[model samples]
Structure formats: structure tokens, C-alpha cells
Target: MDREFRYTQKDFNRARAFLLQLTGIKLADSKDSLVYSRLVPRLRKLQLEDVRRYVDYLEQHPEEEEHFINALTTNLTSFFREPHHFDILSEFIQRGEVVNRVWCAASSTGEEPYSIAMTLVNVAGGFASSAQVIASDIDSNVLRHASDGIYPLEKVNPLNNKKLFFKRGVGVNAGKARVCAQLRKLLEFQKINLLDEEYPVKAGLDVIFCRNVMIYFDKDTQEKILLKLLSKLRTGGLYIAGHSENFSHFSHLMKPIGRTAYIKL
Candidate 1:
């Protein structure tokens, strides 16, 4: 929908600066149109006349910050979106002698953590019965959906062990599935901003699946985040990244042990 609002270069700059200041996402100049398109709905919803006015409203109303962040943040995730990582996770569990604590640092819409939970459940008997998974994200909106554990039937069809982890809906709830209570019990969904200096998780996490979200940050922010994630991981623990994220430059903190997977050294 074309916004009945004016979106000027100055306004775009202001919006970009605001997003960066709040979310640590540095938008490229080319993203001006993208930002305009994304925020136009916000302006319409708030009955604001222009991007400049929306900025003013945001500055005045700090409570709207969550809505602003939610509006711009992208939440594209699915169960077992990256299958190879799950394979690596399974291997790690098989070789481990102790119980593992896993954290899905950017658990957008809960798919990655759910996938991790499925793997954990598969190996629970032989690997370790005490394994736990924590799924977290900065966006409260997606976390709510993740916590609900409801997904469209088509979106979850690709999961490898469908019958084991999901219950397909029938009758009035047809064409959807709810994550079975057994699998859902393994995950604790919460809100977590990566830019924060400290996380609430305990030390010595055995696995941290922080996929796809790092591409949004610049090199400096990426390094800072890497350090924080590494600190939370135990020695010989694993840190999984998105296939597109190349952290080879930070060899001091972690070394690549598999495709887009690293071991805390």
C-alpha cells in the first residue's frame, strides 16, 4: 500500500540512525526504500503524516520502541531450516560423555530451537538424559508464536521425524500442527537481544545455535557478539553459525570444525 506520507532522504537517515542506535543494525544507503516500505505500515497504523513525524513519535514514546523493533526485524525461520547443523549436533551428542546445555541464541519463531530439541530427544536415552535447550530471540512477537508452538502444516512438513515431534491438526484445526507436549517441554522460549552486554544464561553451555542473525550486524558488532557467545560456551563446546556467516577471521576465539560450525577452543 502506498503510504499517504512523505518519506524523504533526511527522514530515512533519521530512521536508519534510530534503528542502529536501538538494535545495532547499520542499514546501507540502498536500504532507504526498504526501510520506507517497512515503516509505511507503522505510519499508517499510528496515523502519522510522514516518516519525520513517526520518528518524533518514537522519540517521545519509548514504549513504542518494541513495536518499532518488531516492525523492522525479519523473522524467517522453519523447523530444521539447516539440516546439516542438526547432523553435527547429533554427532556432538553421540561423542559427549556429559549432559549438554544448548542455547538457540536467535530462536526466531522457535524453529531452530525446536529442531535442536528434536535432536536432543532423539539422543536423550543414549547421549544424556539431563540435556536442556533454551530458545531465545529479541523479538517478542515471534517469541510468542514460538512459545505457542503452532505452525502451518506446509511449514512443518519437511521436519525429518514428523510423527515423533509434531501432532498434525484435524477437524476444525485442520492444516496445522502443534508441537507435541513432549517435545515442547524441552524448550524454554524467551526474549534476548544479542547486543546486550550480558545474557541471562549460565556459563558452560555445550552448544549455541546462533544462525542467520549475525548477517545483520557489521564486522565490529559481529566480533563483539562472537566474543560474548564464546564466553558462554565451555571448552570443546560447539557454536553453530549460518552458512552465509564466515567467522574464520576470529580464529583466536573459535575454529571452524564443520561447515558453518565452530568449536570453542
Candidate 2:
């Protein structure tokens, strides 16, 4: 069959439904162009001219689901993406009110969790001695990269010549920075799907960095996840989200003390 290169409204609807079923990301009709733009590379890579054929191939090959998810998911994150949250975290640690197990719920590619580790190391005084950073993501591929603890120099641009926390190297694998063994020792990366059952952590966390991840879920799912996170948060713990995300709906459960940052009451 000659693959249909051009996408129609039907194709857009089908793709949207498939993605929604697979990842719960709602793609509105207006996003048809965006979907086409993102999926075109996948089509080209597979050498398939038709979107329908690509969809069919995906249905038969379940393992390729992750590739589709990675292609569609927007992972715009950075070390200390929102600096104020880290400031709040530093303050929380100074209060000395709880255990220091920090969970970076959507630790895409490790920057956020690593940033948390660096902040705690810088400001926690003796608290860093006991602090543990757990970084988790649903995407195994990104989690592997995070666990490796190596990043392109550009990715760590926010470090701002702070060579104390990282070691710069140049050889056959030149132009890359790696987290020093001391810093990497403080981090643990795992593959976690938040949409599944409430995550089980061995210890109650002092801070939950669920940043920028809840925006993808529907209102009900967001509330459900928020409640689950709250359950794991020790009293006086902090829960941080993306700048664009708010817990106004769950204001009863969390007290907002700063911009996009919340404290469990």
C-alpha cells in the first residue's frame, strides 16, 4: 500500500486518541499541526510515508510505545529551574524539623534532583550528612542518562563556573562535564510511573519535587497524585511544582508559602 504522507483530520483524531490512551496526554484539535511536526521525524526515521501505517506498526510493536512517548512528551527542565523553590528548600532544611529524604518526582534527565543535592550540600550545614536524594522518572531512557551522571557542558551552563561540584574533562570524550563522585554518591535514580499506584518510599520525604509534571494530567488525576504525594510528605515538608502549575484546587491540603512552592500543613 502506498503510504499517505499528508495527514488529515481523521489522522489527527486517531493519533490524539492513541496518545491519550497510552500516556493520558490530551492533544486538542488545535494541536494537529504540532502533532504532525513532531511525528514527522518518527515517520522519516521508520521510512514510512504514511502516518496510518506508522500507527499500525506502533500498535503491533508494544516496545516502540516508549519511543512514541519520548517523542511527544515535552521535557523542558533545568538545574534549579525555579531558583526560589531551592531557596525555600534551603530554609526548610535550616528549620531542622524533619528527615532529609528528598524525592524529585519528575527528575527528567537528573538536573532538578542534582540541583537539589547541590543546594543541600551548600546550605544544610551538617544536615547534608544525612540527606538522600531520590530522582525518578517514568522514562527509563532518560533515567539511565540521569543515573550516568554525565551531561553536556551546555546542559550544566547554570553551574556558572562552579567547578567545585563538578569535574571538567576534555579528551576523546571532550567538551563534557561529569558530576564528581562525591556529588553523585548523594543521588539515586529510579524508574517510577507516578500515574501508577502511590509511590512507596522507605522514609518520609522532607521535600517532594513534583515540579512541572502534574500539568500533563487531568484535574482528577492531578488531585489524586497531589494527595498521594501529600501522604508521603512529613509535616513541615515542602512540595514544589512548575511555575505554571498551582495547587489552588488542593489549597486545603497544602499551604502555599511561596511562588509555585507549597508546604504540607
Residue 123, model 2, lDDT: 80
Question: Compared with the true structure, what per-residue lDDT tens digits does model 2 show for residues 112-199?
Answer: 9888988888885523466789998877768887888888888776674358677777896577788888788888887777876758
**Which candidate should be chosen as best, given lDDT against the real structure?**
1
For residues 167-224, what per-residue lDDT tens digits would candidate 1 score against the true structure?
9999998999999987787788778899999998899998999999899999899889
| Model 2 / residue 51 / CA error / Å | 0.8
Cα RMSD of predicted structure 2:
2.9
Residue pairs clashing in model 2 are none
Give all candidates' CA lDDT scores. 0.86, 0.80
Candidates in order: C-alpha RMSD to true structure: 2.0, 2.9
Which runs of model 1 end up more than 4 angstroms from their true locations?
1-3, 97-99, 125-128
Output the TM-score of candidate 1.
0.94
lDDT of 1 at 33: 80
